[model samples]
Target: MTTLRALTPADASGIRRIYSGAAVTYLMRPEMTASEAEAYVARVIEWSRAAPVAQYVLGVDVAGDLVGVVKLGRRPAGHGRVSYVLREDVWGRGYATAAVERLAAYAFTAAALESLGAKHHPDNPASGRVLTKAGFTCLGADGGFVHYWLDRDGRRESSGQHREGPGVSPGRTRCPRGRSSR
Candidate 1:
């Protein structure tokens, strides 16, 4: 089963390993060394420990192994910008879609956000597909990436059956003890 957990400094190693090579480099920028990833994780942990924080980042795990990360970053419009990354070895298994979907619901609730946006390199249709499966739609290109958005009502208006209401965000209240609510 897939799970989402609050990110920890320990995950740096896994993330460092994933963010390599030409393919991932095309999506994730400024490829980091193992030591740099560790430093980044340390920064994340420190910032999260600070109360009233705006950004929320979570590690994606499967069967107790770290596989990816999802972030709901604050936007100037009182909403969020979603971003996620997965271990290259675990690609094409729907984990990215599942993680982003859970995070989208959580953003609409836990953060009391109205909308969440995401962007992917135009060439990386796989990333775009993950967002689309998670309920985001194209919003054209911006800053060298194709953007997507998912609003509160858009999520609720879907033809697919859903239980979460305006107050029903995933990965936070719906998720118990960092478990996958998907």
Candidate 2:
């Protein structure tokens, strides 16, 4: 099961665990050091607690175990970007896709976000597939990364299932506790 909830300072440790594990994976190449990853987690926790304008950082976990994070942030009066990372141990388990789906739904509900999008390093097809499953389509290549967008209707152009974006995808999974999907 996947959940999207508000993250608290207490979640910093779990978030750190998730991201630290992630940094070693291909999803986040040129990984950061442990201390740096810890600092990164601290910042995410701070941001989640602060709830800055046009941004929401969430943590993703499964069955009470912290595993990943999903982030949705906008550039102040601009489009929002959705991004996620999962531990290598959980790869190929569909956790990434489920977390993205829940976060997309929350983005549509919590904020009047016009669209939710993400980008994956060109070398990472798994990331691309996860975003595609969440209804995001390739907008074009930018700075070597493939961009994707999911409009307000939850309709993802890249999914190829709908020409128009649907407000939310067909499934609305349960939101777990202990962490939010970033």
Candidate 3:
């Protein structure tokens, strides 16, 4: 089972492991050291506490282990952007797709977002597949990345057979506008 929840201080180590891998960070950012990952988790926790929260840095829990993170950043005009990173060991599984699906549901239903956008490095076609499986339509390549979009109506239209995964937990909070690290 996969669940999304607020990041706790305890999650820093697992987060560190996820960010420290070159395979995982290749298309994201530089590999983070333990201290850097701790600092990043601290920043994310603070963002969650902000008034009219602009960002959600939720820990992706698989079974009971923190395996990755999925972020939703609110943008202007009721639109938002979503991105994620998972442990290399978890790659090829459907966790990323499931996590994205749950996050989109929360964006449209709880955050009241009209649309969500995402982009992936062209070299990372797996990421593109994940976005497509989650209901985002391809918006073509731009700025060296393949862009994608999913509006409220589009999500609804494509999610006709959507079913909540067992034990899935979507975090509760509003998101804000910002750039995502993934």
Candidate 4:
């Protein structure tokens, strides 16, 4: 089973490795280019040491293997966004959904955060499903992207009146292989 733990300097190398692997396969727009990936890794290591008040970054280790990550980012004005990425090989096995759910629960209970949000490229239906399963509501579309948010109560609240996107519908009722439906 995958578990989240406080990130430490010892985990940096593994985290960097995961970041480098993801840089090549993930479609996140803000991800660093190949040449800049190393530099970004170094920056994350530095940032990890500062102990920022509202940012909760964790290493997602599954049975001793660092498989992914989940981070809670707080902007200058206290707004927050939670993001996650699983190793490409583990895609579609429900790791992303489990990580997002665990992160949301931690954010609301441990961090005492006001709100958490994320944006999915409209083309990434898998990512949309993960966010929706974690109880995020699609607020609307902007620049052809879908925006979602989860409030402090662990329920979704839309920022504006909008029609449901693909994620708004209830997802599969059956659990994925090797897991039980809750």
Candidate 5:
């Protein structure tokens, strides 16, 4: 089962492990040191306490273990941007897709976001697939990244696989095989 929850100080070590992998870091950031990961966790925890909740840096848990992170940053005008990175060992297992799907539902409903944008490194088609499966339409590549967008109404209009309403239960659901290291 995959779940998204708030990050805690205890998640620093697992964050370090996920951020240290080459495939993950290549798409997300430069390799992170132990201290860097801890500091990152602290910053995210602080962000959670903000009045408007400008950002959500959620820990992606799979069967009780922290396997990755999914982030959604609020933008102007009820819009947001989504991104995610997973531990290399867990790639291609559909965890990223499942997490993204749940995140989208939350953004559209609980967060009251009207639209969300995403981008993936051109070389990482798997990330693109994850976004598409989550109902994001391609907006073409720009500045070395392939961009995508999902509007709350646009998602409802599409007759795709993700037609379910925003009330989707936060339970285990099978997803397509893909990685989302954005």
Candidate 6:
């Protein structure tokens, strides 16, 4: 089973292992070295510690092994940003969706956040699907990526007229393994 926990310095190697060139390119550009990856996690850990609300980063732990991360980013004007990354091998396991959902639950209630935002490259619709399953509604594309947002009380729409896109329907979501998000 996958569990969510606070990220620590010990998660460096596991994180280093997952943030491959292919994986990072989907979200970021740099192909990080082991030391760089360690430093990145360390920095996030430090930020989490310094935050008034401990809603910064969390590790996705499966059977005591770290496989991925979920982060609640502090955006300007009180909105939050939600993001996650998993090991490439674990891409289709529903882990990212579950982790994001876990973080959203915490952010909406315990952290007292008003709204959370996310974005994905237009080519990476899998991530959009994950965001949708985790309660984000697409806000169309900007700068080669599609944006999404989820507000408290389960609302995820930018306008009342538009509901879903392509083949998506309201309240309908597909898991990473191609199963329904039921």
The whole-model C-alpha lDDT of candidate 6 against the native structure comes to 0.74
| Best-performing candidate as measured by lDDT | 5
User: What's the lDDT for residue 58 in model 1?
Assistant: 85
Query: Which prediction has the highest TM-score against the true structure?
Result: 5
Model 1 regions more than 4 Å off: 28-30, 155-182
Assess the local accuracy of residue 50 in candidate 4 as a C-alpha lDDT between 0 and 100.
Answer: 75
Error at 60, model 5, angstroms = 0.5
Query: Each candidate's TM vs. the true structure?
Result: 0.79, 0.73, 0.83, 0.70, 0.83, 0.82
Relative to the unseen true structure, what is the C-alpha lDDT of residue 169 in candidate 1, on a scale of 0 to 100? 34
lDDT of 3 by residue, 1-182 (tens): 88999998888899988886655654556887888888999999999999888998898899899989999999888888898999998998899999999999999998899888887776777888888888876555555666667778865323322222111123311111121112
Q: Which ten residues in a row have the lowest lDDT in candidate 6?
A: 173-182
Q: Each candidate's lDDT (Cα)?
A: 0.72, 0.65, 0.76, 0.64, 0.79, 0.74
Candidates ranked by lDDT: 5, 3, 6, 1, 2, 4
Kindly indicate the candidate among 3 and 4 with the higher lDDT.
Answer: 3
lDDT of 4 at 153: 68
What lDDT does model 4 reach? 0.64
Residue pair clashes in candidate 1: 105-170, 106-170
Residue-level lDDT of model 5, residues 74-124, one tens digit each, is 988888899999988899999999999999999999899988888777677
The 10-residue segment with the lowest total lDDT in model 4: 172-181
How far out, in Å, is residue 115 in model 1? 0.3
Tell me each candidate's RMSD, in Å, in order.
9.6, 9.2, 10.3, 7.2, 8.4, 5.9
State the lDDT of candidate 4 residue by residue for 4-96, as single tens digits. 876654665565556555433445444445445455455656766775555666778888887778888775434578877766667787877
Runs in model 5 lying further than 4 Å from the true structure: 154-182
The total number of steric clashes, by the backbone 3 Å criterion, in model 3 comes to 4
- Stretches of candidate 6 off by over 4 Å are 53-55, 161-182
